[model samples]
Target: MAFVEGTGDEFILTCFVCKNPFGLVAQFCGYCQATRQQALGVERARASQQIISDEPEPQPVHNISSEVNTPAAERVKKQKPKRQNLFFQNMRLRLDNFKEWQIKRSKPIGATASALFIAFTYVVIQTYIFVNTAPTLDAEKYLYPAVTHEVSYFDASNSEPATAKTDIFPVKYLKWSASSSDRWTTKASWNGWTGKADITFTPAGNLETDRPVLAQFTAQYSTYWKVFRKITWEPASPAAILKLSYPNDKNLTIYFNGLAAGSISNPAVAAGSYQMYPGPFEIKFYNLNTGRLIDKYTRTYFISTSGVFSPSYQN
Candidate 1:
């Protein structure tokens, strides 16, 4: 039956005419101003009184006996559980069907055909889509977003691959030379300082030049350039790496050029650095626990002589 159920207090009653809870013991429903007796099904066929009425009037006297019901709010809450259960039932059925489809797809014949299809698709995408998709970038910024190129390189003689920070806008393509002896050297002359390569953004373009330049050089020493796509350019700076050799007794906070650079979270490692210019910089180490100055030094930093900017600890 559509009706409000009253709890504990007799003075407190919920008027079915408006579904508003009222604490007044009165003859009329306080909220809807309906005759309290008629709304409670105590009387029927009373003139439909209107006094700021927002709710439907209580069921007719004749219909009240068979179809009276609880408040709409309570009915909605009771239905939520049924709806949730039905939704979960449908979801479980879908998951089971998906599992069955996966099992069938894993059968030997299907699996082999699927694997071949996937392999062929991957090769095609790599050869055509990826190759053409890797839009050529200049020494400056890469073209915006539609396509990308992640240019990296490695020497055939060396195992480690070399990459540079692409986050730098308007890059001059100068730092990547640190990876090879001549980064762009094709001369028959192979030396310790000759990067055999130069700082260049033309990772794939190097192929054309590599042939003509290395024509005189030994083919035995080879370098490979690999380019890919999709990269997020984040803000970064040229960091001056300062390696510390002395073992520390406690964690120390480092300051560079009189500004707080960072703190040594791991006291065990004596080497790390901060982002600063390559020049004379003041370094001060303070006790992380007590904030007392320990070691202070003004170290002159310069790029290492090697083509690779190998950082050495300044004593």
Candidate 2:
């Protein structure tokens, strides 16, 4: 039955000479089909041939079907032609276009996504630092050790912890008394004026001496050397005593000449040595307890009194 196939939707066309399905839905054999295509070209050339007025007109071929197809070919003439579905064809075109667009845009989309991710990461890191890291200063307690040194005061005020600016006053106003004859009565003092504000001193080293060197002052500033806002001092001798008496609470960092000494928590500091010479100092008074910076003085001075170099620090 396949040998007698027709070119219908359910039937396939077959070659008469080979007696096999041609696989193509056409009337002729494969070899014959090729020959027909070549003949069609020859026929088209012949039909286009025309002569000038002097030449005789060529006769056109009439009934060329008889010349191309023999009587026996009519018996194998196939029926029906295959048609493609319009919707499926359009869908294929759309899929092809979509694939092309994706290939072209993939790189830009990926780069944009990566940039957004990096930006987000930077924002997160900045937020973390803002929340956790603390600056190296607290101003309100710069000279008052009681406010900063007392934990209860900080708790009540709810202040942030601060870094110490080791340099307070440039001069060592409190010096060791060499004229002391009594081992328990020798004294120390300061002579600079603080304009309108009261001055105070905080010792950085040994406050005790060979003589009584009475550890008291005429005024509050005479006890506290606050002339040069930032200062340092060096001792000719190692056991030189320095005394700093803070009437109230404050936070301050004291340095021994050029070396880093330590922090002071006591309001009244006595019994210290040359290490008490707070020199090479810097001051930024930020009150961590109050969460603000106040007492912003910008003057610094160093002076020598009675063969002794002292620092007078100012706001």
Please report the candidate that would top lDDT against the real structure.
1
- RMSD values for the candidates in order, in angstroms, are 31.5, 26.6
Model 2: CA > 4 A from native: 1-105, 124-128, 136-172, 175-315
lDDT of 1: 0.38
lDDT of each: 0.38, 0.33
Shift in Å, residue 108, candidate 2? 5.4
Indicate the residue-level lDDT of 75 in model 2: 57
Residues 81-165, candidate 2: write the lDDT tens digits.
Answer: 8798999999999999998998899999889999999988866654454333211122112212221122222222222232111
Off by over 4 Å in 1: 1-160, 163-246, 266-277, 280-282, 289-292, 296-298, 303-315
* TM-score, model 2 to reference: 0.17
